[model samples]
Target: MYHAESFAAMGWETYIVGYKGAKLIPSLLQVPHVRELYLPQPPAFIANLPRLLFLLWAPYKILFQALTVLSTLLGELPYAPEFILVQNPPSIPTLALVQLCARLTGSKLVIDWHNLGYSILALRLGASNPVVGLAKMFEKTFGRKAYAHLFVTHAMKGVLVRDWKLLGIKAVLHDRPPSHFHACEPTEIHDLFSRLDLRPAGEDFLPPSSPPLSTPFTRLRDLPPSSLSPAFAATLPDRREDRPALVVSSTSWTADEDFAVLLNAMAFYEKRARAVNSPPKENPQKGDKHDRLPKMLVIVTGKGPLREKFTQDIDECQKLWQWVRCVPMWLEAADYPLLLGSADLGVSLHLSSSKLDLPMKIVDMFGCGLPVCALGFDCLSELVGEGNGRVFKDAGGLAAECETVLKGFPHAPELEKLKQGLVLQKSPTAGEKWNTWAEEWDRVVKPIVTHRPGVE
Candidate 1:
């Protein structure tokens, strides 16, 4: 979407072809200069067949992808495109198919390396698996032959260049959030929360004496932060100035990212919150009671295949936990960024499939001036640096990090300090690495996308 949007803004007509029902940024389709060609998904009976039947599935899967992509790129496009940009990982037959189609259509192929398809397969099947070995060889053959290559991290670029001996243009294209993501105003937050119809975690957490109330969002839209309620209080809980800690995390719920890590962290956090807030059985004394983790509402957003299972896990966790509420939801494109901006803190459990690609969610969180605690991996430090975020290796570490930053919640100086650091990073002059998507696109990508034969 970023590539298409940027190209469209640069006055170039862009064509984006993908599976018809796959999730796309809704705003992408609205761009006047961009045309979208959606391909049909394979028949449900074929696609939904048990995964163990690889014999029946693999050939159909490859043929479907190959035929659809080839037909769309070659037969349906308005004109013969100068270049075709493709995302890697599910590279498989797509790479081979796209490469063949690109040749037949007299177009250049640009490969965007998000991660290695072989590495992702290694998570499910061991590295020693023969199929994984074949995937690596296939990617090497096609990926290395790209007209240009875009990498998300220096580490990935270095590794691929050295090992695969890749051909053509290569550049580290760091992922930065688009302009839609920024710290939202109080009114925007309130409007989103009101529409969410946020219920309390349970009766034990807060006792609501009155029936649920409603607000006309239009009337509240123009109000200032002071006139508006704090975001965490927008739920059906106490309407006092005090608010629950609002933490947001978004995921597609794929197998690569272990959702269980977050579930465990939330459980750990719940225990700590309860321990800190509960009255002691012995001599009753309050010593710096305010300096403890606040009750939290952890909103996990985005949809995926694992959503039903994850929601079931959340339900079970809620049964035993009182201080934190974990709920799964899907947000509209515009509201997604607003929620991130309105959040007190963000959590990312994106254990990268290849350990060489940084989580895009962390980038969005940083863009919204929301500091994050993200799962650590090889190339993560490139995006998640010291002040704005912290890295955790496990669920316990994540819980501890969350407790550190959010300790005195609602008035957490630690969280505010991180947020300030993220705010500074929005400036192009903040540091070389802080360049916005537009600036970086102009510097690194525009030249390649716009280059002409025999033209400087």
Candidate 2:
């Protein structure tokens, strides 16, 4: 969507042909020169087959997707585009089919390499798995000879080039948050929470077999439909001072992110929080129930395959937790950025499938001027090189970092230091600060997109 938006803004007649069921924003749908074309989704009975059956049906699924993609590319477009820009790592049928489409249509293929698809498959099946070996071969066979290649990290570029002996115009285009991710002022924060007052939408977030996960967060609410819906009064941290330290995290509830690490860390923090010396002990008669450390309200946003299981775990764990509360809620497109901007801190559990890639979540957090404590991986230093965030190896290490950084909670000096570092992390364009998604996109990708392939 970001790439298509950028292309449309640059006056390209862009079309985002994706599978149906993808929840795209209305703004993207209504963009001037951009169009949406969706491929039909398979029946739920076929799509939701058990793991073994799903594997057995993989070949058919791939064939169906390939045919649809080719049809969309060849028949659905208003006219043949000069370039067919595609993202990699969904490299199975999409890459191979797109390659074939590019050849048939006589268009240039520009592949944005996010990560190696084989490495991601390897995360589920071991590295030595035969399926993984075949996928690597598949990706390598079709990954070469692009018109221009854009990568999220320089490390990914270097490794793929060396291994696959790729020949193309290669560039590293680091992910940058768009303009909407800026920090909110106190008044803006209050207004956002006020407008986003919670409502019950059990059908969206609850399991059909079970009663709505009586937990606070599973009830997903709509923004536009309920924008004027009578504001049912629910517990909202409307006042910034009165609220616990608001921590935000997002996930897709997938194996790539080990949410268990975060759960364990929060459990440790909960125990420590309970053991803290409180003013209530000293002033029992006055009934001042205050502690040196502030309570933490961590709200995780995003819905995915693994969400149901993880939410259940949080539900079980929160029963024993007092000082720390972990709530999993899916926010609407408009409200997501607002919550990120209003958050006191951000946490990332994104473990890259290929260690060469970086997480865009932290970039979004940095865009919101929210300090982060990210789960460590090999390429994390690339993003955290400026000391804008801290990295931890495991649950214990993450717990230690949380205790170290958020010691004073709402008035945490260490967190403030990190936020300040994020503010100072800027780029100079003609000696002026110009560090936004649009500018950076123009700086790196625009040149490649416009350059003649014949040019040296």
Candidate 3:
């Protein structure tokens, strides 16, 4: 949706082709320069091949993809787009068709890679699988043939660089920002949160009489520090504001985003908080009466089978924290600005296990100006930057880091400086990465699309 919207805004006609029935695609129906061609999914009976059989020869999968592309091309010729931006992974065979059509018709092929599907699939299925190896070879060959490539993270580009060093490909590193920012407003945001019935975690953490920290904590690096303008700071009541702590939020309620680390971290945070409130080494109280224990509330906003499973885990950890709120996945475009403005931090946690690539929520977090706290996988840490984000090598470390981060909420002077620095350094806003990417495509692709062979 970010790419399509960006290109459309740049005055280029962009058509997106994908499986027809998935309602979860980033909604792009309203963008003026964009159109969609949804293809039907393969019949379940045919697609239900055993893993061993599917892995036996995946080239046929590519051949089937080509058939899908051929059908789509025959149906879409009337549009005659100047360029074709093909998102790889979903339609491997369609990519070849798009490339062939573009070469013949003078249209440029821009291969957008969110994840190296073959590499991920291979990782999941084991490298010994014939299909996985074939797919990797096929992907490399196709990448070499592409006119241009767009990778969501430097890590992804690194993978291609290591694998295809001789190709001299100009693979661009692009960012995905939210589509709603083009026209989001405060009232719309407030209304959206109200509709969602969401509250700030800190408010939920403390009693009404306790004064809340004036500013939310956030990390800053590679761009201007978030403190200079207070532009993206969550608008909680302003008290004596110190630099806000880096706040990261994620619901371990989905298959894609890992919940175990989050659950463990919740447990760790409870332990650390308890330790902080415990009696000093010199004096030990036999029975201290405290009204409430310090806790961090994590608000979740999605649903799935994974969510159902993780809800039990979250419930298990409630003995330590005051509450764990898992709301329905009801947030809309209008709600983001307010949440971004009010959120001190943002979080996206995913398993390092292959198949789950970059989540769009990371882009949404950057758009809202919240520094991300995400598991370090493929391209996440590279995109989030070392200073502005935190990444764990594995699930074991997540709990300790989460506890350390929460206990040390935005209290340091350096934290404020970091925010100020990022604000100054960021050129096009982080949210503008996709928008800029669309313009770059026009510059490189338009002339190629329209150039005459005989003309200089």
Candidate 4:
């Protein structure tokens, strides 16, 4: 969607071709100007088949779907499109068909490499599988045929250059969020919460209270109301003057992320909180405000296969620590930005399938000026650093970091520096960036398209 919008902004007549069951299909259908070509979605039974069977069936399904998509394109497009950008990793039959169509229409081909096809298959089927080898062969052949290539990270580009020897006008285009997602004002956050029904509609609003240096920060009790739906706000606890620090993580429930690390971190944080709130019996720091522990509200968004198991784990953790409340639920696209804006801190456990592609979730989190605790990966230091966020090696290290942040209370110096770093980090807005990228891409591919044998 972002790429399509960017192309449209660059004065290109944009059309989208995809499947019926894609995540943003419904939203895309509503846009009047963007022509859409959709293939028939697989039936539930076929879609739900076991992994091996599904993989076996996928090639036939993709081939049939590709024919439908190509037919639709031929019928709907008045002229051959100047450029056809195809996303990779369903790369076998789809790319072959796309290459065929591009040949017929004299359109320039561009492959946006998200990941190699074989890498994804290798996760389920071993790397040594003959099928994996075949997929890699297809990727290399078709990838080398494209007029230009776009990669998400420099590491990805390096892999292709060294391993596949794919050479062309390639560019590294990092994903960015829309301008509206950047550093929201306090009032904007309040309004968004009210609109999303995360806060009560007509109640008196209290701005988050400042943290005190001397006393225990018990005043940080009021937190974002918890409910799967906004209508359940009435059933939530009464709003307080101060809100607890909000920590959030969004995941796809896949093996790529280690949710156990996050869970263990929370457990460690809870233990540290208990020790802080209740001092040792020998000294008994009764009146000391510095010993007070701050409250936390952790919201992990997105539903996946591990949700049920993780939910049970979260329940067990909550039972041990009353000060901590964690909720896991699927969020609509409209609610996602609001939830991120409301959060004070973000946590990411995403381990990249390839060393090259950075976690886009962390980028979105930074766009909202929410600092994060992310797991270490190749090229991660390019995005995360000392002031903006910390990268951890294990659950214990992550947990220790979380405890350190919470213990600092309402005004941790490190937290303040992170917020400042986010503010200082500057880049073009998503639209501007995309428009610039499209212009550059056009310059690179136009000669190839125009120089075709049939073109005047």
Q: Which candidate's TM-score is highest?
A: 1
Q: Tell me the deviation in Å of residue 189 in model 2.
A: 1.7
Model 2: how far residue 312 lies from native, Å: 1.0
Model 3, span 1-456: residue lDDT tens: 556765666666777677754343344666676777777665444334566765444556656667877777656657566667777664456555776788777766777776665655654567677767776776777666655666655566666667665242344445545434322243443343334432434354433332122122222123345544656644433222232232445443533466666676666656666766577777765433332222444555544446666666665557446433333343444444446545545566765334324666665565555555677765454456655556775555765555444444434333344344345434466443334334544444334444522211
Query: TM-score ranking from best to worst?
Result: 1, 2, 4, 3
The global Cα lDDT (0 to 1) of model 1 is 0.79
- Badly placed stretches (over 4 Å) of model 2 are 25-30, 43-51, 195-239, 279-291, 427-434, 452-456
The residue pairs that clash in candidate 2, if any, are none
TM-score of 1: 0.89
**Per-residue lDDT of model 2, residues 1-456, tens digit only:** 888888888988999888765467645666788888998775556555665686678788888878888888899998888889999878988889888888988898999998889988787667997888999999999998888888888789888889888878888888888877889865466556545533322223222321121222222223454445466533222233434677889887777999899899989888877776343566656522333566777888898878888888888887766677777888877778788898888899989998888888888888888889998888788787435888888998887777777777666788888887777775352222327788778878787778743322
- Report RMSD (Å) for each prediction in the order shown: 4.6, 7.3, 8.3, 8.0
Over 4 Å off in model 3, which ranges? 20-30, 43-67, 100-106, 153-162, 165-169, 176-189, 197-257, 278-294, 300-305, 323-330, 333-341, 351-360, 377-381, 408-418, 427-456
Residue range 1-456, candidate 4, lDDT tens digits: 766755654556778877754266233444456766676664556544677897788777766777677777677777898888888867867788778888999887878887777777676667788888888888788787666677777788888878888755666666666545655555445444444422211122223433331111122223356524566432222223255667889997876788889888778777777877776788775635544556777778887767889988787767657556677866777667667876778999987766677777887788788889999988787668886788998989987777666555575666777877776664334333333334434544344434532211
Judged by lDDT, which candidate is best?
1
Colliding pairs, model 4: 215-289, 216-289
Q: In model 2, state the lDDT of residue 239.
A: 35
Task: Report the lDDT of model 3 for residue 106.
Answer: 78
